[model samples]
Target: MNLSRPLLLASNSPRRKELLAGLGLEFKIRVKEVNEDFPEHLKRAEVAEYLASHKADAYQHDLQNEILLTADTIVCLGERILNKPANYEEAFEMLSALSGTSHEVITGVCVLIKEQKAVFHDITKVFFKKLTKTEIDYYIRNFQPFDKAGAYGIQEWIGMIGIERIEGSYFNVVGLPVQKLYTQLKALGLIS
Candidate 1:
């Protein structure tokens, strides 16, 4: 794909990078550490959008001829948001809570070009089969999903065996919602 402006991706997430690359759009990775904190009142999609925009805001002064992309993915179980786990115990607990349940995976994306910005979010409902304690422990010990939100990767072993189905874009669960992102880029006349 050809972009009208050079692309700068403001994230270090390997999953996000891979997903964007799969879209065949070339971009340079230019991440700066930004505060991921958000207000307590923001719910699922709101939190993700807020964080994505917050990341984009860090690059506000850096734009020249390049379009900036930032994205944040969050997992929500009912009213609770499951952030990345701090350690093995947290990962186990997160997976336990997610077992035999349906959760929403929301990926919020921000595309910024000079003074213009577009922010949107995509949500995927993921259904998990009842996972055993052993399965949870095994996944945590072997996969080490400390960097992934919800302490799980949908393309990993746990998901291969535990996820029963998904109602939205599967790529959204991995990290990026490429379809919606492509639409947004096209709408902005960044891609043809």
Candidate 2:
């Protein structure tokens, strides 16, 4: 099986790299400056998916018969969308809102190769147990979850202690919907 077409990952996320590596497929990474902004009319899930596809559009020139994968994840609660934290106060606020509450984690995936393009989004409903002020403070002070959406990592200590339940793909919360991704990759002939 000489299934190779030069897979390229258009992201700078470590979690995305880890998840893709789990598929046992070799890939190279490249990123371009693409505007993450989306139209204000778009809602929660749409925001993530739209940005994902738009982000991949920056690498259209690099397609060259090679598949390019790009993704974006966001934590949405109520009408608010929580992206990566810009500062400690915002991170604290995001965590505080998420405590003892259920929120949706939406991850949007874009796979493109030449004229073929596929885009999809997955949603995971995660319920966090009532987190204490001290617990939140500890996680914020120690772990410094500035790079993760919603100021938390589902695979981290807060998730270990605070996550009560989840509905939908667990990997989605971790950043990539691996099973769905496998299906899409297979359908798109990106993998064997």
Candidate 3:
């Protein structure tokens, strides 16, 4: 991919940074403070897309022909949205709820180039083997995934052993859907 303008990533997530870098695209990181609060009526994918667009909108005033990227990931089981856990106990509870069940990992991405903007999302269905309390405790103690949505990282130890299978883009679970992002960038004429 080629770009005429510099790429700006407006997220603090290392996973997103790593995934984007893997595509061999050079970008500058610019963290923006935005409230992730969404309307109560939004569910699943809508929540992520809304938050991602909200993050991108923060840079609207300062954008200058730069391609800005922003994304949000959410884990959904049934109708419940499992956001980043605030505490260890919440982490344990969220994992326990996910044990031996299938959940959806939705990653919403927004690409902004001046006045042109595109918002899209990818959903990956992940199945976890029944996790033991000891395993969950060990993972929590060792990884301390408090900053990650769903209290877990798909590229971490827990994902290696706990996740039985996934039905969609694996990178989406990690944080960013690179394939989708690349396609979107090409469609937007930001890349070739």
Clashing pairs in 1: none
Q: List model 2 lDDT by residue over 1-192, tens digit each.
A: 223488888888898899888888788998888888899999988998898899988888767878888999999988899989998899989999999899999999998889788999999999998888899999999899999999999999999999999999999999999889888888776565
Q: Which ten contiguous residues of candidate 2 have the minimum total lDDT?
A: 1-10
Tens digit of per-residue lDDT, candidate 3, span 9-79: 99888888898889999999999789999999997899999999999999999999799999999999999
Q: What are the runs in model 1 whose C-alpha is more than 4 Å off?
A: none
TM-score for all predictions? 0.98, 0.96, 0.98
Q: What local distance difference test score does each model get?
A: 0.94, 0.89, 0.93
* Clash tally for model 3: 0
Candidate 2, position 80, lDDT: 90
Candidate 2: residue 11 lDDT (0-100): 86
lDDT of 1 by residue, 52-167 (tens): 99999999987898999999999999999999999998998999999999999999999999969999999999999999999999899899999999999999999999999999
**Candidate that would win on lDDT:** 1
Clashing pairs in 2: none
**TM-score of model 3 (CA atoms):** 0.98
